[model samples]
Target: MAKHYRGREETPKTAETPRLAVRYYPKAGKLQLLKRWKDREGNYQVGPGVTLDAEDLQLAAEALELIEEFVGSLGRGGRP
Candidate 1:
């Protein structure tokens, strides 16, 4: 079985643009994209917002692209 790795890796050295951390819940059949942002205290805050369906491949692809763009905008050591 493939191991699932949650977002627990070390944060990059440089500031990272906001990236969507996607989670696929098989039992729920919904894709959850986490909206991450830094608080005023410079602490990381991740919240769940958009919920999509697995059957919608196009939507999923679009979401992925959007997330990539969001992360890439951060500049170096950002989301991949």
Candidate 2:
């Protein structure tokens, strides 16, 4: 079996309200996108889970642009 580890444990009402985080998983040797938000129960949830390998730079850039655009559109509107 492959050893696995996780990162980015976000929870409700955090001071930073984390914006999309990217992590490098050593065992997997890939970059993963962690977009998390709090549910009603204050549990962190990852939605639209994403992962990228070395060859996926273009896709990664595009996805980041889209996310930024979406967030910009929601300025001061409400939470994510």
Error of 2 at 25 (Å): 1.6
Candidate 2 residue 74 Cα shift, in angstroms, is 21
* Model 1 per-residue lDDT tens digits across residues 13-54: 222336656566665355566687888999877775666554
Write down the TM-score for model 1.
Answer: 0.40
Among these predictions, the greatest TM-score belongs to: 1
Tens digit of lDDT per residue, candidate 2, span 1-80? 22343434432222223556555654444566768788899877765656655444445778667767777878667655
| Worst 10-residue lDDT window, candidate 1 | 7-16
Residue 45 CA displacement from its true place in model 2, Å = 1.2
